[model samples]
Target: MWDPVTDAYVASSDSGAPPNGERFMLYALSQRTGLPSLPLTSIGYVDLIDSSAGAVGVTLVGTPATGPPATYARYCVARGTASVTSLVGFVTDGTTRLELRVRTDSTAPGTLSVQTAIAVAGRDVQLSEAVTVSPAGGDTARMTTDLRVTSGGETVRATGDVTVDTTTRIGSGRMTVSVNDGAFATLTLGGPDLVVAAEAGVTLTTADETTLRALFSTSFELFGTVRVLFTPVPLSRASPPVDERALVSPEES
Candidate 1:
């Protein structure tokens, strides 16, 4: 029958000749336009075959994926006269997230995965490196990036990470040190020094249980609690001490 009011085809048969509804039109459009339609994982209306007594036809399921990427064919499960829903599912690398909703007539809740593609901003760099520079001959050394240091003390007193991308590089380019008398340790400069320094002859106790005796410099941010562990040492105390003929911050503080 024709829906004179809407000017579209109306239900002229009993419960609409077999599968004759919007689905029929959509399916026809897909066939004619060669456009793919949604796929159902499974299709099963509440029927007498598998349904117990008092059950009504109301379900459509797509074939489950053997492992992943389960393809769903477009279909519907009618409870009785009017109840339809849609569902889609797929998987992709964690670079992305997916979410899908499958509608239904029943009150029970159901969930289905929807998204399949994901991407991240950067390459997501995850790496660790340590470059130690012990300035010699009274010269400063610089680094290309920030640094992570573990000052020595019982059971290694300090451990921290920092990014040193600074223009004012360290004066000392690089050198090699005996790592706790174990082996030759190469120390190179990284970003703006993620600087660890001391006065001409100040000492710092490090985690390696070694008191870097003030043989050449003081502890790098060695005075206070280890809370300020990673970033640049707080300048308040690190600034040049109040001494005769000296500014708060030395020319190179």
Candidate 2:
């Protein structure tokens, strides 16, 4: 089962190989325009099994490629409205490349409708990508765009945003905050505030201080904790000891 709200798989079952040579059927269903729509896949053959309960269905067994361009397609057989022999679908096990395109419809101050589109499963489909609007003025500024991945009328991935900030020029802008994209977390540098926003269910970590420093300056205000190293130096020897400065400057000595 798929959870439309969370965009996740709820429960699943697998019947191994239809119990030795028993023929079974398979069906693939996807969403099309707010309804169940079928996509293009390679399903060579399928057979149906009728049960005493008046239900018709088939068991799905075998592993498919897990990752990018992958989608959840219901693989099952149905006899009629009240009799679905077997109800099963894809339980994805890996990541997919979710592409998002964002642009504003208008630059006027009121409510700039930022448009967005997400491409998944090798198909370009329309999905909402508007999270927040950009601040309007003669000068350019940053805007945040949110996205939710949906397929066959079910949300596959939850909502997230891709924000563009510091629009210095037409092509000279950086993503301030973004989520759900397959790319690395967004990196924002300004006003002494350093923010790192990773995709949902993903944790952000730096390998070492050098890597962190490269992304943020020492004075940056990080939202989380970090490891700091402090070196200790031995106290100056009792007395004035030797004057190394006078040694280097003979005239002063």
Candidate 3:
């Protein structure tokens, strides 16, 4: 049955048995249908499944509704026993893609593992990190990430440690960047934007400065902070009424 209020399809088994044994599932779909679409035009789908182990698993996929159709998929599984959860996902927009995997277990508290990869414009970046969560020690989590970025020609890499306060939702980290196996700059994370500083005793050549400007921006040297922003895209056509909802749940005049 389609529930417009929830924007999901709900299905249940017909067998006259207890709900515990019965199979239940839901598929939710989301799409923008108006004159103006968000800067990132996308549609989303979510699938919720009930397993015999009494655990619910979710699979979500999203793609651009318009433009080059590139898809992203996310999978998450929660086990009834051991309170273990695993998540794997990938996001891509034709030119760029990011893959992430995470695993956590309540049975073994204060430990988590994360791995990520990014591919963009012939460049590849990979990161692996372990996080330690301290519930009593200031309610914070600390992680050290080893990152490597490589293209067909030059290679860049970084290493950083980030501390996140779970309660305050604030994070602090500093990453030292190296270009072609040479020290380049350091990036500090915590404030509204990213702060960049040159590595001590490292002088940037003209080519190095050009590379940095190309990677960051022309204002990379003038402004130490980098801010990323996005703007919405307006649609030319108006949205049509959702007639499918009436087939499931009729509206009163």
Worst 10 residues of 3 by lDDT: 225-234
**Candidate 1 weakest lDDT stretch, 10 residues:** 109-118
Cα misplacement distance, residue 81 of candidate 2 (Å): 41
Model 1 global lDDT (CA atoms, 0 to 1): 0.24
Model 3 Cα lDDT, one tens digit per residue, 1-253: 3444554445644453234333222232235552223232325444454543534444444534456533443333433234444444454544566565544343334443333333442445543333232233655555454555566577776666655555454556666778788888876767666556788788767676555434432112101100000001111012211111111111111
Residue pairs that clash (backbone atoms under 3 angstroms), model 2: 24-47, 25-47, 30-37, 31-152, 56-85, 57-85, 57-86, 131-146
**Candidate 3 segments whose C-alpha is farther than 4 A from its true place:** 1-9, 12-44, 47-71, 74-90, 94-108, 118-136, 189-195, 203-253
Candidate 2 regions exceeding 4 Å error are 1-111, 122-128, 131-142, 149-188, 191-194, 197-203, 206-253
Tens digits of per-residue lDDT for model 2, 138-244:
44333333444455655422222222222232212223322343444554434334445565665667663234334332111110100000001111112211221
State the lDDT at 40 in candidate 3.
26
Worst 10 residues of 2 by lDDT: 222-231
TM-score, prediction 1: 0.15
Could you tell me the lDDT of residue 16 within candidate 1?
A: 25
lDDT of 1 by residue, 156-189 (tens): 1122211221223222333223333332233333
For candidate 1, the per-residue lDDT at 11 reads 47
